[model samples]
Target: MPTALLDLILPPRCAGCGVPGALVCPRCAAELHGRPACRMPVPTPPGLPECWSAADYTGAARRAIIAYKERGRTALAHPLAG
Candidate 1:
């Protein structure tokens, strides 16, 4: 389906902040984009490869993840991936 047509029926909203408009508002997108850092959990599991993340699992980033993974907002996958 055409994106414009789909949006007309279910308006796009920022996956992170729930703001109307873009799937991820400029502010949230900026927040999600950052230097990748090693965010290994405590007591690293055996054979776990080094994990790097661009944004900490909190605030807008956390909300976005929940929306994509838990809430079934699959449309957010593209923005969140970036």
Candidate 2:
């Protein structure tokens, strides 16, 4: 409903590169999760016992997180989670 109207009014663009016509372009999606998952940090956060990040919170990854968490674009989660 609202998502459809918003797309019609203002076409969506890739959160990473601003490429129009897609929530996230295929090119940028491939760049995600490049490193192997692991518990690498020396002193883990207070109560976080262990954690594994898909990718560093920087560049396209950061923009993707902001778009999903702040801007309400849940579409990015599917690819981001992979």
Candidate 3:
């Protein structure tokens, strides 16, 4: 099975931190923190709807955005879009 092959060849590792034995190791994920959702909207110049963001464009969110946008990490687009 593919699962068996994966287990044999490449042990699970955290996507973010490369810790062994888990796709996303809890300890490393915990270190990547997110702030409270302030729910504020800053209007744009071209009359676009005010943008609502959960956290500021820094840290994990920023990296994720860059990865999804510039680096073509389309896998994250759907979940992040919402």
Candidate 4:
């Protein structure tokens, strides 16, 4: 599985805090910034009815998205998805 491969290639580390164990360790992932309610577009072509993102793409959201897309940190996708 990709997780096994990741374990072999990259040492376990918190996606947000960079600690160690897994991408987006529970503690740091829980700490990642989030908001109440706000409409945002889905990250796909055929956008559906207005979707609401859990976190505003300002500080942590911006960083997590950039890291996942530009930096190829696919492991962070789940957490980013909120």
Candidate 5:
């Protein structure tokens, strides 16, 4: 499979910091969880889906999303969901 071949050629790396070994490092993962809190939008957009954010969109959390989506690091979904 193309994915399998690519895996062999490229070592797994954290989507957050690009550290080889894991899809998302433990530290970056920890940043994704906390007491779930309600999030509001500025001016409160109409028909916005009710959702909660694990952390503010910055640093590791931001980078991880970009990596997972743009770089195809699907493995990050587990940690990002934490």
Candidate 6:
């Protein structure tokens, strides 16, 4: 379906908080940014390249990730990337 038509049928909401009119609201977007930190697992699996994340995986950030990966909120990719 065309994106415009789909949006009209089901308006986008903030993936993090369900706020109407945007894939992610300003407040939720803000929650997605933070100083980078290493996210290596405690067990340190073999060949697991060092991973890092900007925002801690909690609160709004966790919700947004769940929405994107498990709830079909693909529209959140851009905002989450930022």
Model 1 residue 4 CA deviation (Å) reads: 12
With candidate 6 superimposed using the best TM-score fit, by how many Å does residue 14's alpha carbon deviate from the native? 0.8
Clashing pairs in 4: 12-21, 15-24
Model 6 residue 18 CA deviation (Å) reads: 1.2
lDDT of the candidates, in the order given: 0.84, 0.77, 0.53, 0.66, 0.75, 0.84
lDDT by residue (tens digit), candidate 1, 21-79 = 78889999987887899999889999999999999888899998898888777777888
Off by over 4 Å in 5: 1-4, 47-50
Per-residue CA lDDT of model 2 for 1-82, tens digit only, reads 6654677789889988899988878887866767856655656667765567767666887888898888878877787889
Candidate with better lDDT, 2 vs 3? 2
| Candidate 5 backbone clash number | 0
- RMSD per candidate (Å) reads 3.4, 2.9, 6.2, 5.4, 2.6, 2.6
TM-score per candidate, in order? Answer: 0.77, 0.72, 0.43, 0.55, 0.70, 0.76
| TM-score, predicted candidate 2 vs. hidden true structure | 0.72
lDDT of 3 at 33: 49
lDDT of 4 at 43: 64
Backbone clashes in model 3, listed as residue pairs: none
From the highest lDDT down, the ranking of the candidates is: 1, 6, 2, 5, 4, 3
Cα-lDDT of candidate 6: 0.84
- lDDT per residue, candidate 4, 1-82, as tens digits? 5554766787966656677777776665655646667566556457466666666666545666777888777878777766
**Candidate 3: TM-score?**
0.43
Off by over 4 Å in 3: 1-49
Judged by TM-score, which candidate is best? Answer: 1
Off by over 4 Å in 6: 1-6, 41-49
Q: Model 3 residue 76 lDDT?
A: 42
Counted clashes in each candidate structure: 0, 0, 0, 2, 0, 0
